[model samples]
Target chain A: MTLWQILILASIACFALKLTGYVIPPALLTRPTPARVANLLTVALLAGLIAVQTLGQGQSLVLDARVPAILAAAGLYALKVPFIVVVAVAALVAAGIRLVT
Target chain B: MTLTPETNGAARASLAVGLATAAYGISFGALATAAGLDVWQTCFMSLVMFTGGSQFALVGVIASGGVAAGPSAIASAALLGSRNVIYALRMSPVVGSGWMKRIAAAHLTIDESVAVSTAQSTPAAQRVGFWLTGLLVFVGWNLTTLVGALIGNLIGDVSAYGLDAAAAAAFLGLLWPRLKHLQAQAVAVVAAVAAALLTPVVAPGLPVIIAAIVAVVFGLTDWLGTRTTSDTEGAPLA
Candidate 1:
């Protein structure tokens, strides 16, 4: 499928998921297992994304400027920096590193 | 208009949270463009998906894997959005009745809105908070996304700006808040390592999904066990 198709399809699926909560019987959907699984699944997907964006180049992992950039981002996040600032600073860090190297 | 303190407080909270969370849209917009989405596509995503986490994850998958990973991208995005279903279940009572209201509420059923709504003491305050936050964020996020997308398009070469790194950082920021517990931390570590290892062997999108499955299995085993920390400790997701 094309990216546009995927985009619309994904949006529809997400919307369906949201609508399900309203349509489904609340008592039946309140199980603890699904909730816990969903929560942890989010964490897992995010972690995987972080790893891929930082190191993966197509099929290979390469060390580059993104490493320090992400580290700097983590540092800012630790210090309670705002989300937008963290992202901007991370890009700056990576760009700066690339320019220097 | 006359308002109770609770209603006033909810409004105030909603404004603060909405603006703060919507600010992240600029980052998401830039990253989505850098990931190869056109401005219209990016805006459409903000308008239609309407969920920050899922939008970012979808664009993140495309960034790493390209259009060829469309299936996995859709899966990741939809799965990330599954939380909204749970949010909706909780929000149903607060939304009251009427198909029109329910439909609109479903569209606005996101992490920020839910958090803002649940923070209130009364149904009236909760409804006020939910609607206010949802509308404010929807508008602010889309506007910022447009601004960021234009900037991204003007920049042309995405890597020169290190938006790739910025994308990683954004994901890191999202994951950071959820890492207070040992189980959560362990899941993150295992997922990261698994994805890193699998990326070279499998397709781009498959690694993340596979790693997620592996991490979920590990997490469910409770190998690292659970901690007694409060679930509400972290800042709400954008």
Candidate 2:
């Protein structure tokens, strides 16, 4: 499929999933099992994304400036720096490392 | 004519969250274009997908594997978006009845809207919180997304500014706030390790999906024995 097709289809699918919650009987999916799994799965997917974005290159993992940039982000987050600032600092850290090395 | 203090508080909180979330649109905009999406495609995604996590997931996949990885990109995005289903379930009653209202509410049923609405004390305030936050975020996100895409188009090399690292940091920031529980921490560790290890062997987008499956298994089995009912209750805004 073309990018446009994927975009339209995925958006439709996402919207349908959202609508399903309202139309379906709440009891059918309100169980503890599905809810628990969904929560954990969300976190896990995000964790996986962090790893992939930072370390993965093509089909392989490579160490790069993203690693330290992520660390810098974590540190700024620990300090309760705002989200935009955290992102900017990470970019600066990565760019500085790239420039020096 | 005027809102009660409580209602005002909810509205204020909603706007704060909306603005905070909208700030990420610039990153999404820049990164989407960098991932090979044109400016309009990136803006369309912000307008249509309208979910921060899913939008980032799609662009992230494309960034790594290019457009040919469209299937995985969609899957990853849809998977991330599945959380909105949970939000919709929680929000159904809050939205009351009316087909038109439900349709519009479903579109607005995102993390910030749900969070702000549920935090309110009264039903009227809840409605205000939900709609205000949702609309504010939608407008702000799209506007900033256009800004980011335009900047991305003008910038010759995204990597020169370390936007790649910025993307990774953005995900890390989203994940960081959810690391309160030990079980969640365990899942993060295992999933990160598994994804890193599998990236080389598996197809580009498959590793994250596999990691999600791993999460489901761990979540269902209560592998770490730290799972509790409370842990599944709330999700922070993305």
The TM-score obtained by chain A of candidate 2 when compared with the true chain A: 0.93
**Residue clash pairs of candidate 2:** none
Give lDDT tens digits, candidate 2, residues B121-217: 9888888888889999999999999998998888847678888998888888778777787777888989999999999998898889899987788
Distance from true location, Cα of B100 in model 2, Å: 0.9
The worst-scoring run of ten residues by lDDT in candidate 2 chain B lies at B227-236
The runs of at least 3 residues in candidate 1 whose Cα sits more than 4 Å from the true structure, single-residue gaps closed, are: B222-235
Q: Pick the candidate with the highest DockQ.
A: 1
lDDT of 1 by residue, B2-57 (tens): 59999999999989988898788898888899899999999999999999889999
Evaluate model 2 with DockQ and give the value: 0.76
